[model samples]
Target: MRKLIGCGLVVALAGMLACGVGTEDGPGLQLAFARQPLDAPCPELPGEPGSAPVLDAVELTLLRADGTVHFRKRVSPGSDGKVRVGGIAAGEDLTLEVRGLVSGQVAWYGSAAPVNIRQGVDTTVGIFLAAVGDVSCAARPLQAPRAFLAAAGLPGGRVLLAGGVDRLQADGCGPGCDAWQATAAVDMYDPATGIIYPVARLHTPRALASATLMPDGRVLVVGGVRQLGLQAGSGMFLQVAPGDVLASFEVYLPGPDVWIEKTMPQGMVLHSASLLPDGRVLLAGGGTAPDEEHASNFAYLYDPGLGSAGEVVKVTSAMATRRLGHAAVVTAAGKVLLIGGAIYPTAPPLEEFTPSAEGGVFLEKLSSGLPANLMFAGAAIIPLRPDEVFVAGGRVYDGQVLQPPVTGNSRLIRRISSDDAEWQEGPALASPRWLAGMVTAGRELVLAGGFGDEQLTPSREIEVFDPQGELAAAGQTSVERAGHAAVPLVGGQVLLAGGLGPQDVLRSAELFTPAALAGESEQ
Candidate 1:
């Protein structure tokens, strides 16, 4: 086990719930959870004052490292919703999954993997078991309204929100807006404790950048603009300008919470950064000039295993084409699949990239059954199984409008390996969306607001796409949100932070909990 969760009884103090309920004998574990309300002062310094989480019991499951079930039981928690279990086998690497229950349904879930037990020692495991499928507000919003910011989940259930525009300045925003400025400000949110802390600022201001959590636990950031807000030309089109893009990348060290910046040979924006199986980050396919007007076929690899001393390696061969607003994912075969994107006005074909054994050539055009001319740039891809994923929603080319129409179509790609792959049809979305906020909650794919059919307006409809079932309406938010940061709290609960709302940059926030659907197992 790398680290053990600190076990303790989180006693209620001024509405704050404790982690575990009690202690047990002979290599025991004390487990507890924290929950959020529909409306809470999450960032209020003195204390997290809000309504209580509704949990009646906790279902506990203990397993060996090899997937063998060691112990399983459902016990009623104390007033704080905690339970303690003892008599676990000592010296065994184990896994623990805890579920919070309300009215006998699975509402919340969390787990600690590869845990070890020592004789007569107690393990304290604290988890955040947030309510599922509920929309609530988080208090003390981002110091200011932000749009196009990047957020990533930190170790220990915290979230890091970095670099975005604080406001749409006089330069104007989309539609009638001209330009917006980016902020270097950064913050961290701890869902377990319900607190947001002001952290170290970025060395350079950025927006629409890529942030990836490295294997060593530090966050690696790259590619974004500082002062250039995407301008809507002719009052309907939007794209990032080139000169304002940042060429450097930064790393967020956990303990000090400080960002260490490093320079890259070339600058890129609207690119896809994929963390490889070997602890390296492969950046592929983005616009390099004229708001991506001149797309470049460039690729860079960064090995972050060396901590702050890591380096970014440039690739020898260029990509299949210049692609902007693209999406990439590490495939089951370990190849980097650079999916649908636009080479300016043209949507390029799906290209598979292999850095390890491709003879210095990374990009190889692969075939998918998706519409030949469909340009689903910046589409949402959700993992269904280890070898399967579903790609959804992006702007498609249409001659009628300056900007192509937003799509509600989703194509399922089953990639067992490099040679074996196929694209399956619909499970189409109820509403068409581009740049939508998406989250994979166990088997459920929750797609929140984004740019909808009306161009500048945001989509308030929230839909749940289940591959095992059907696409259904979960709920809707009062505010129209898109280009926002969606951070995962304890047990896959999502915290939606600031983003653009029609004509204004918003400071408002929402806490979303997925529905604990029946028959869903531990995530």
Candidate 2:
């Protein structure tokens, strides 16, 4: 009996030894980092000594599926200019983020594709870092201090910018004291040359307007605030007096470089305009009066084929709710989905507008609303798929002091049928954002700079959201911005232009070439 007991004890000791050995031999990930040869010139600060940026440091972070940081390490490159990070656990899928810094500034930043660790083996991975794309200043617009300006991409890779405040005086007023008058100045941006040339100005000066590209290649510029006479003692430009919303509309012809004045039934501001499948523009829900406090429930349809005079038609049925700063998108089935707006108390319900048999429009309210109360969120339809739409980064008022809370609850909603739709919680953005520029490039959704709750400051971080995967950090702009314009270029790249930047209104613009295409160009 003593020998038997000793044998059991020996076996137990052996089992424990085996477990210890297994842990020591557990799988790990081996990462090797090398800087990719850049085809473009490295970025340099003006009057700086260095001709090209040099790598100073690299930050490595391993994130779990939920975007929580699991392990973080900072390392410098070896003599061979390579970094190796090991000891990652096996069998767990992880996202690897590598940020390269030059003189403490982010020079190159990217994420490695998700990696799967294998037990008992060292998984080897190679990461190549490239220089951040070159950002050269484009020609400034003819008019200075352009704010709340409208821009639309033309068919031939050109962008039309129009109607914003141009400072007229600069005394003891303030930052924008000089610019009190909205200008009708129009400018055309040529991407090939990185220059903007003045074009014909609009008949009426407007600001905070909506510009939509028409089916015939003309651009339709709709309602905005036309400034009344500036108050004598006031240092700032008064956008409008009471009941001073401009009902005038205009169509810009690229061929002639001209703006033809048109008229709308009602003056609107902060309204959303979407192009329908039938080649008509759906203008809906804006502030009827100049003040944002008074929102309109009215909707209008502008028929471009009918020519300039009396082309806008008012929809007989009014919207279920008055919306200001709302978003609208046309679905795959030719229905319009009107999303969250400035309405308060409870989250605004999702409403769909369907075309009726009698050449009218029908409005139906959907039971499934937004995940939360959202306003000024950047929204866009996922490319190639009409049924699914992506909405991200908006402000939600929680009945307290105004805070820019990053809900981290953005989502993707699909229209299963005319009335049936489903919502799935999407990957959270890297940071909370509102009033950002959203556009689709290839299969990825690109969200650019926006205002965040962190100090109420604008974010320069650009996050790319893959519908099938997680949000990956992407290239950033030269300046922090919100209320900017992001227009997808002919290629997969995006043209991002003017908006409110860190200090004041900006006329700067940059081109965001997708990393894949950017890689190809380097090769």
Candidate 3:
């Protein structure tokens, strides 16, 4: 393989000592390459040699942006005898050319798939240099997790992760037991460095509840259980245990890093909440009581400007059925779009709420076209346009288990458009882990670690989906644990913070880079 240097105008091939292509022992290697992003140009261009016989002397050439040969040279393969390109500067997108002579014949020779060289330390493009007959391509690997997380943010900023569950149900125990630790701590990460700093600790515990970041930058942490058990002394060994599925919520101001306890509609677990465009928080459909086997469709709106300021006002009746572990998102039209949660009956109905206090009317009920499973863990919503809500992975709606299984069926990102609507299946995830956290950055959907079955085996894998006309793999993340939180930063990257791992709970975080958009051309 030859490396291209300079502004795509110059190339130098590392010398090979063998005369003919290598023996037929190994298949010829295929070459591939990717241009550097606009902001970060690679200092060098890396090319690949497809599965082919070993060759002797190879020459690399470059076509300058000015249509002139910038430089050409013969390079001795430093270690592997493969040609190397280096010393590229910023602002240069170079087209590389490679040529190799084998068996007294000029065999491997070809140009690259275009390199986007930017101003950066590591800009890699894999170009294959191979003879036609002996060359073959390599298999593609799974997308990286960090690349997915970084693309979840817009150009302006990233998302903010307040605080979430640190451990799965089986923490510090022998095995097969699930529990949640009620801590008042909340943290946010700096997207640039993936560093997490304590934002504030709540006066009380808010675990496994819903959390939303308001437009004003303040975070709202709502209803979660502080204590464990069923019916306050049923003595039943439920996996989760008897706990306070809190009905009350609190506000955490990022600037002040303070927690303000506020009134709530009613205590519930695994409920859904969204911030309406009007600035009021609309919470709906968790469990009315932790001990109850079923959920109440009862919905409420907390008027932050209302009596006592931000009081939870129960206004509506219940939905067609009760739901927990369902998904909800506020549409661009200011309607609360809810869908795909498990009810007590363990059936499927994706519904939405228009937030009417009078008769408790929702836009419509959606139940028809779901992917045969629903989970209550946590779900991320991506708005395709303004009106469409795309619900990604979550727990399968199971009424039998006290805690819905930590696993999720490989369901496509479900879509809920209007109230009187049917659930539509969108692109499915690369993997099917549940309790995973998701956030959006521009055209990419970022998914972070979550549990597979038990929360202890926290998956650190990060998957990003590019929603540009077609959904595709953007990149992968470095972490492998689950039950963590991911938020977009003010910059282009996203910050991922604490979650559960197999050995112990995590307090660390990482950053994701969405280089796909940054590297590709606009048109």
Candidate 4:
């Protein structure tokens, strides 16, 4: 498989961009786009392989803060590229959109957000344009290969990735193999430039933890182990000592780019963390305290804004059942739903959380018409609509020993009203994917990057959850990936960053441009 190249404008040196030609000049700002070798097969430019496109143009559109178009121009580009765009009113909240055109069709996209333009001043910003509906390699590789890392969306169109193990245990270590002394290494991925920047390391290194984006833009990472290992072949646990089982969590501040550790009465692993509408983080169901590797029904609400000390209050009522690897998501109506999850492949009734001024209540929803023993333990539960979530590929064991039970089956969970919700059957994927990265692109869900085999072999196909409850083939990520971080970027592109391949943890990243973002150009 070929690694799709990441093509975009890089803001290095703040000088000449040869691909795009600017039209007019006034009191606006000056910008340039850096170019990369066009490696992908373009039907329009069949003759140009390594040569730059001098005849191709870029459609530039300036947008007001209210999302209204302020200016639109398609400049006939020249080989010596540098565009000087201007002619805008002062104090206008402006944004610039650039679409690289090949044979009069939009092929690449990038954008810049800003606070208007002024005469004799240069506003420097970076923009990244990725090919639509394709997965390509990042311009740069990750610092190292890592798995079980925590990724949270940060301010300024950046993603914070922290605390993951860099090694892969090829020898059989069984259950204890999942936990290892994690690396404190931290990094930031910028969609604007398609670059991964190494940042401040975590004060308390942890793996298998959940990173939540706080309302204030800070990151609150909870649970997971500080150090754990096992003997190869013997399957004996080791490195279990003081601080090995983390009894604390870390908060990462973006401006300072530092990690601060906070003490907790007990730590947890395999926990489900969800941010509520009121700025409180709802942490539910994981192995906690001395035993941080088992399932517990306890839940808590972590308030990051309360005092400087902050506060972690336990929910009075516990979950209906013990869920180790359960999936949890906050509905559009601000309700929390705990879906099927267990240590193994087992299906459980969905649980909903309703908060009052006094406390939050957890009620188990009856599996009235669900498949008998429907398993979504390793599946992805993502937002489909307001108060609705759709479940995608996961480990669905159906007792067929001859055939692997990993399934492509999917279902939609719709919160019909405040008091009731229904499970609607969704279309099955062409390929079965376990632990797939499912993210919403506009109204559609892009299911990409997962292991399709029982041996944890990665997959490369990209599927879409169409709005009409139908499944359609969108495109491919080209690179095999499992357990990677799939995140939506500023523009309409999805970033699939690092995951485990066949034998080792991967350091390669891929960028996916959604079909909806390209409009009619895809057809």
lDDT of each: 0.64, 0.61, 0.47, 0.63
State the lDDT of candidate 3 residue by residue for 1-523, as single tens digits. 3332211111322211121343322112222222111111111112332233455555555556654654454443334544454443333445555555455445444444234444322343333232221211111111111111111222223234443444345433334444555565554433221123445566776556666766666566777766332121112222343345665777765555577887565676667777777787777776633235546677877676764436777855556566666677666566765665645445445555665434246644544555444643444455355444455556544455434332234334333454345455556655556657667754566666665543335564556655442444544434355645566543124555555444545544444545432221111
TM-score of candidate 3 on Cα atoms, chains taken together: 0.60
What is the TM-score of each predicted model, taking all chains together? 0.81, 0.67, 0.60, 0.83
lDDT of 1 by residue, 294-318 (tens): 5668898887755555877788777
Ranking by lDDT: 1, 4, 2, 3
* Residues 86-186 of candidate 2: C-alpha lDDT, one tens digit per residue: 44455366755555666766555444435555554434433323344433233233334465678888865577888876544553234432334567888
RMSD of each: 6.3, 17.2, 13.8, 5.8
**Model 1: residue 219 alpha-carbon error in angstroms:** 1.1
Candidate 4 overall Cα lDDT vs. reference? 0.63
Residue pairs clashing, model 2: 167-178, 167-179, 168-178, 169-178
| Candidate 4: 10-residue stretch with minimal lDDT | 41-50
Top of the candidates by lDDT: 1
- The lDDT of model 1 is 0.64
Q: Whose TM-score is greatest here? A: 4
RMSD of 3: 13.8
Candidate 2 residue-wise lDDT at 352 = 76
Q: How much is the lDDT of residue 384 in candidate 4?
A: 46
Cα displacement (angstroms), candidate 4, residue 265, comes to 3.1
lDDT of 4 at 448: 85
For model 2 the TM-score comes to 0.67
